[model samples]
Target: MSAALRPFDVAAIRAEFPILQQQLEGKPLVYLDNAATTQKPMAVIQAITDYYSQCNANVHRGAHQLADEATRRFELSRDKVASFIQAYDRCEVIWTSGTTEAINIVANGIAQRLKPGDEVLVTEMEHHANLVTWQQACLRSGASLKIVPIHDNGALDTEAFAALLSANTRLVALPHVSNALGTVNPIQDLTRLAKAHGALVLIDGAQGIAHGGVNVREIGCDFYAFSGHKVFGPTGVGVLWGKAEVLQDWPVWQTGGEMIAQVTYHSATWGELPNRLEAGTPNIAGVIGLAAAIDWLTQFDVSAIQAHERALLAYATTLATDFEGIQLVGTAADKIGVFSFVLQGSHPADVGFLLDKQGIAIRTGSHCAQPLMQRLGLPGTARASFSVYNTLEEVDALFRALKKTQRMLA
Candidate 1:
């Protein structure tokens, strides 16, 4: 937490998002599906509107005044993103559609370098975005895929991870925080262990960045990926931060006008660090809006927000435990604001449907983690994910809704 930051005020924060004030089914909306995407604050929304209304132009290609202003704001957003994650060089941050595309960019680049018998390591708890990309990469290159196991408590098995690394391990990809279970992985330790074996590390930070500070240098991972929508920014924008030297040598997977330096009818040379990987026009307004979101977040102490969320999770957990037949999933000692659980003799989708009648929104189904669900021996769990703007009253409302749902089902 910064000393200069103002103390967090939940009420004030809630007021900044107009969408939260809406009514659903004649009841106030209680949005708990934050893991899927966070609602944008007015600052972020206005940033997008202002971009199109005031300075609508393509970046880095036109010589007009609007183009110049648009380009300046777009690149400034890049600088803000670089600073947000504490990257060593601003040029190391490459824009992508989201975490999914960012992971694919690295996976594809690494696939070109992979040889037969080289191993790509992942974990049993990874989101499909992190897991499937490496799986496909391994298939393309004839390299084997290795998985580190997780304990019954939803925590990564450190002993198992240590044993998996070896001379043939070329890369180790894992999530900083599990989206389904909310387990905060020991990324620093994992990165050190993998690096000791000369394996490149990529940290999927989609859930981690939303919780609090993330310093890539301290973690010492080769690459970090996250999405803007998960971090109070606009959708269709994301960032991939890599070591400058590592990205410099990475093969370009996308090619078009912006990525090229010199081109003829025969062949072409690629551009520098960031642009080489980012081909064609990007989501210009979304990038600007993401910078606004970052700027808005800087006003409050992130530590305060994290503490509030921890309290909410604890409160919600206690309430759920008292409810008959409500079984909590992911009991890791360290977790974030996610609460995943199952109701005995009830389907997760049915529970979600009942909650929706009370104007409560949550996520159900596999959560893009079917393998994780299979590992836990369940179909899926209804997930209620919290954010900075949520309140304790809302937490209580969730349980009340659950009680009503339980009686109706009975």
Candidate 2:
């Protein structure tokens, strides 16, 4: 690896993100809304543009030249995703509209096999995307949805999680990291506990994939889902990985043109693991853009990226904690460069609006983790999440903006 591949070259990395260079409200855009969606790089943008320009065709349905090119690119994107997560085979990778769709696919597929009186386990820290799908699935299947509560520090109670696992537990869906609190959970440990109880495991990796790279096989998880937008790709693409045998046993959730092997009024057969799950026409250009994003990420050492983000997290946390009346939510030993905090007597939305005038974009709300917010006894939190393209200067800018907000409110 080159020396520039080392962590903390914020200047060089920021240059690749053209949007960050532009002004918002007459100031440079200090993008800290990474938890919502990351800013795309030139490579990803170009990939999407080039695909639509040259390879626009329906995938897996035609024999024309454009279709062939589009199909090749689309399938190649699946391969790239499989490699990105170190899955056993590309067949294990299924593309969806985004993480919400991916989780819904798992919930629906597993719901088909569930019986009344069964249970599905989850935690209070889950994003609504992970929570509601299982909740609805259990309701439809006549199975119960069991939740493991969190401690005051916003960490999952592992012992409580263990207690929730039982012979009747059909599945355990949990987040690898909390989107609201940046709490990194012990996914492997949870998977082991669920497996020991003879239950399947699914991990929601939306925030986890943004901070650290994952290998689904290494995690020993039955299923893993994440969105491309969280990992610097386009918004429309996401991935769901399952064990080949597990997916092979799943009934098709949707039916349409490309996923069918053969069809009749009385009988229809679906394709293999991935195609069976991915019904209808796939998102060709978005998938191609995701592949390019993965390629761009692979060019630099991931270890260096993790290290850089950790350093930034430490600095940012220290700065934020120094301010009075600012309460930090999650205090996990392991966390991504995400911080959610609340200033005394100030609503998160107010803080967010004040910061926006300075061109510091952040997320302020329940962050789709309403259960977590309820557990913490707050309405919501102001969240500043970092990406590799963010710099120390941007972190300083955030502090300055927060101080200005504080002064104005006081």
Q: In lDDT terms, which candidate is top?
A: 1
lDDT of 1 by residue, 263-376 (tens): 999999999988999999999998999999999887877778789999999999989767889999998999997999998888999999999999999999889998999999
- RMSD in angstroms between candidate 1 and the native structure over all alpha carbons: 0.9
Record all residue pairs in model 1 with backbone atoms less than 3 Å apart, i.e. clashing: none
lDDT of 2 by residue, 67-163 (tens): 8998999999999999999999999999998889989888888888888989999999989999989988988889999999988888899999998
Candidate 1 Cα deviation (angstroms), residue 291 = 0.8
Q: Which residues of candidate 2, in runs, are more than 4 Å off?
A: 1-8
lDDT at residue 271 of model 2 (Cα atoms): 80
Collision count for each candidate, in order? 0, 0
The lDDT of model 2 is: 0.88
